[model samples]
Target chain A: MSELRTAGANPPWDGLDGSDRHAACMVAARDGDRTALDVLVTELTPLVWHVARGNGLDRSTAEDVVQTVWLALLRHLDRLVEPRALVGWLVTTTRREAQRSWRTNRGQVPLSVELTEQLPTEDWLPEDEALRDDRDRRLWTAFSRLNHRCQEILRLTVLAGRAEYRAVAEALSMPRGSIGPTRGRCLSQLRELLNAEGGSR
Target chain B: MNDIDPRDDDRGHEDAAVLTDLGRLVHELDPPPVGLVERIQFAIALEHLDVEVARWERAGSFAGVRGDRPGTITFTVDNLTVMVNFTSTGERHRIDGWLVPAGQHTVEVRVADHNSTTTRADDGGRFVLSDVPAGTTQILVHLVNSQGEPGRTVVTPTIML
Candidate 1:
């Protein structure tokens, strides 16, 4: 996998980083091109969704948060001068909105906290209906058992889209220059969990 | 600087492999809901949406004194704050709302997977959308010139009505 990633050595989607592409799309959308805005929405929807859901919001609330972020961005997009700030801005907004959902329904149990209780140890992929194989199912179970912070970091990495370690600093609030070591530790933790069962069904 | 660390590169490879497995696991586990893209597309595709995207400030619902009636939901955007009270009459839902800093503008109610309704606000920034079927929905405020070209537009997130 690493070989394939580094084999090209050049980033995909034209060497423009994720933020640059997003900002460019925003500009085009502003110029009356609906298609450009669609591109922006498509590119960032996953990132925004994961940011909300990964932080512990249920699916419905997470989707709400994502839509809220888009609406907010529509108002503030022109105010954002630098393009690179886009990802950081979107992730932070998602987290804040998800927290708002929590505050609104204080009586409602948080999906993240109630997760373990809702799903017994045997079923880790409860959120997923299409579990392809037993090996993946085992890995998911171990993953679900990860602490919230670890789960958050790994999930953001999955959505970074070749964003480099700085995405950790920007998205996860990790200190600058420490994402490499932090990611290494997090991965080793998962490796330990997977290897415990020989990573098989 | 000194020579590149071979162990560091090897660890990088290891981390990528682990993350790949992690990605596969999570993607399969919590898949995004179907039709998310289309829903967002419809919400974002207002005739004059590119004018400006309104930022969400705060939202809350307050119950009545007796608690027997449906609660009122208040949604605040940067340029406007909308307070919606829902009442069901016969087979249709009624959404009575007010806009802040307000004047008459076209209020469009977007229902997910359902038809939308448009209403015109009064001089007091108040409007009532009557005979609307209840479902998951949201609102958009549009300002149009005398020539009928749209000006600034404000959008709210899709919510249940």
Candidate 2:
């Protein structure tokens, strides 16, 4: 922990990077540093957003889930045993909250129809309109081609960055060892799709 | 066969580059809703860290035929239930709120990027905040324990007004 903290007098709190930074920020936040808490919220919100979106939640619902997860963190700040595991804790909480919201939205559907509804559909994402550039459109088109698991894994791993593989793996319930290979295969498959489209064009 | 595949190293490097590019593209395409972080920060900016956040019960929007009626929403946690009705008058808005187990309490309406309005609920558990600027808002009910000390605060999720 001392190593994670900055050295020398008047050292800025922003010295650490990656998970170490998160842990340091968490420690500072617990010690009543509002600035550290703000940094944590700004830095981690995107990862939390992707986690919620990856769970197939609509925009509004995902937004609510993201807020709820952060509120939960604020409430449980002292109870979090390992500040270093903050990403994993947040990812897992987001998934749970997203699933809860998803269930609430689908509560009216009959049990028999619910299973079918659970299957990934080809509905247009709200973000589709934002993909204006031809390159972005093409990449999204290929991204949409992958299976639900592949899409989820790729989206989360990429958004969380390479340093957060352990957190992503644990949150997704996938073996830690499999994330790298699976991500590799998924990227390769995406490239193949992109190449095929390029050829056709 | 050797445990190491020569292509593995190169593929890993290539995958890293592609993933990085894809991450950028993904962000460009599907960024979180604008101001979401700031809104969350504003909502959680509580003076007391130990507080109870009321669960969102239900919200209903009623568009008046002539655009006159008010929209109502409610939140609950444990024994406390807070219900607020929103009515628009010109550009500003009015929030009339009621708390269950009716009693006197401090009611604060927190508006994002704006100074929060704090008012006291009457003995009947009624409070009103008038001329509120339109933006994201949240309600906080400050409770007093039987001993008349500062009890746990109950906060509602961010609501659009």
Candidate 3:
């Protein structure tokens, strides 16, 4: 068990950083500035995609989910109060849309297979020399083995590292207080899994 | 062995190694294929064009006849329900409708053309166009309506096409 150093309680995510971009986007979008909306969409598409995929939505469905989320954004633009909350709002909306899309379409056919089957096989190859030499395959394998929640939380918070704990907590439905502890625990779990699989060469 | 603190050992070595690897992997993972900004930008431009078209339709009439414009329109355009309180005239127009389909069309106003100034409607009846051009030009419109119907409208620009 690794000792958690409170995972940097401040997290340097203080006031508004990425959320500022979202605010700018909202203002632009509100003034009927499609360019700002385009910028917003371009920057956040990956985040939404990852969110959809992390939520167990298959690729095609996830794509639909992303599209739906954007459409919803257009509808909700006037109702939004804070510009900074866009990230959290989007993530939460995407999750809800993805789940809804999955549930709605799951009965017709399994589209998740399409996305997972289309998974980038090349990622299996460790690109970094340090990670490549000894424990690359094991680490990669362990990553795939991580449960959906862990994968999503890790990717959104640690990988993207764009949103704050409040946003992350709202998006993931975890307790606001538990975000730091859970993040630490999730990282610890990953390390443990890696170590058990002969990590660090 | 009794004095050996496992916590310190784990923190000093294992955690650092894992954190480093996690950081590397996170940065290294390729992002999924995204539509180019240019493509989105194009779509947005089309959307703006739609908004401008909408602006003309309600109270922003170009030739005293509102909602009468035509061009290679986008059928998949979204957010068309715009409520504009025109400062130019102190009037408001709430124009909400689906994208019009392709064909010869007419607009009481003009839509600016800034890109190729021409595009073909997709099978789904959406076209990418630049700003509407100037002068008494005949606008060709092939667009789909909100109900996804193939339709056409032809308009001579009274404002700025």
Best by lDDT: 2
TM-score of each: 0.66, 0.75, 0.51
Task: Sort all candidates by lDDT, best to worst.
Answer: 2, 1, 3
DockQ each: 0.26, 0.33, 0.08
Tens-place lDDT digits, model 1, residues A70-167: 76776566677775577778877877777666666444444453352233233222554466766676677667666544565678776553343233
Q: Which candidate is the best by DockQ?
A: 2
Model 2, native contacts kept: 0.33
RMSD of each: 8.5, 6.0, 15.1
Which fraction of the native contacts appears in each prediction? 0.41, 0.33, 0.09
List of chain A TM-scores, every candidate: 0.69, 0.73, 0.70
Interface RMSD of each: 6.1, 5.5, 14.2
| Residues A90-178 of candidate 2: C-alpha lDDT, one tens digit per residue | 87787676666555455633222234224443453555666666666666777766655566667886665545343343444334476
Better of 1 and 3 by TM-score: 1
> TM-score ranking from best to worst?
2, 1, 3
Off by over 4 Å in 1: A1-20, A107-125, A128-132, A161-176, A195-201, B1-14, B47-74, B77-93, B96-106, B111-116, B120-127, B133-136, B141-154
Q: For candidate 2, give the lDDT.
A: 0.69
